[model samples]
Target: MSKKLRNHDEVVFEQLLNPEMAKAYLDVALEEYEQDGDLGFFLEALRNVVEARSGMTSLAEKTGLNRQNLYRVLSPEGNPELRTISLILHHLGYRLSVQPIQS
Candidate 1:
C-alpha cells in the first residue's frame, strides 16, 4: 500500500475552511504583523484564508473587485488599501474592530 502525503498548503487551506479556525489564524497573523511589521506575512495569511473560502473569482464577484486585481493585491508584494481590506474581511464573514492596547 502506498501512502500519500498531503501538501502543507492543502492542509492549511482545508483547516481554514472552518470560520472559527480562519478567524483565529487571521488574529494570530495580525498580531505577528504588528510585532514584525512584515506586511507580506499578513497578506499571505489573508490570501490563504481567501483561497480556503473559495478563490479569487468568488471573492471578486462578492466584493465586485477585479479578479486580477485581487491576485495582485494579495501577492507578497501587494499593498492593499484600507477599503479593500475591509471589503475582503466583510466578504469573509469577519470585520475589523479596534481594542484598547493593554500595558
Candidate 2:
C-alpha cells in the first residue's frame, strides 16, 4: 500500500487557492497579531498567499520590488512599512480591513 504525506507549506499553499480559506488564514494571523502585536505571522500569511498565487518573482515585478528584497521583506524578522505591505497585499488580491472588537 502507498501513502501520501502532506507538508505544512503544501497545506498552506492549498488553503491560499480558496479565497475563503485564504481569508481565514489571514484572520488567524491577524488575531495572533492583535494578541501579541508581532507582525511575523501576518507577513508570513501574506507571503504564502503570494507564493500560491503568482510567486515571489511575479509579485516583485508587479510591486516593483527586487526579488531578493521581497524575500527579505517577507521574512519573519522583516519590518516592512505600511505602503510596502499595502502594495504587496494589493498585488496579491487582498486588502486590509478594520472592524470593532467585540466586547
Q: How do the residues 1-103 of candidate 2 rate in per-residue lDDT, one tens digit apiece?
A: 8889999889879879998888888889989999999999888888888899899989888878999988988889999999998898788677877899999
For each candidate, the alpha-carbon lDDT, in order, equals 0.92, 0.87
lDDT of 1 by residue, 2-102 (tens): 99999999999999999999999998988998998988878889999999988999999989999999999998899999899999999999998997887
Q: What's the lDDT for residue 75 in model 1?
A: 88
In order of appearance, the predictions have TM-scores of 0.92, 0.90
- What's the distance in Å from true for residue 91, model 1? 0.5
Pairs with backbone N, CA or C atoms under 3 Å apart (clashes), candidate 1: none
Ten contiguous residues minimizing lDDT sum, candidate 1: 36-45
Clashing pairs in 2: none
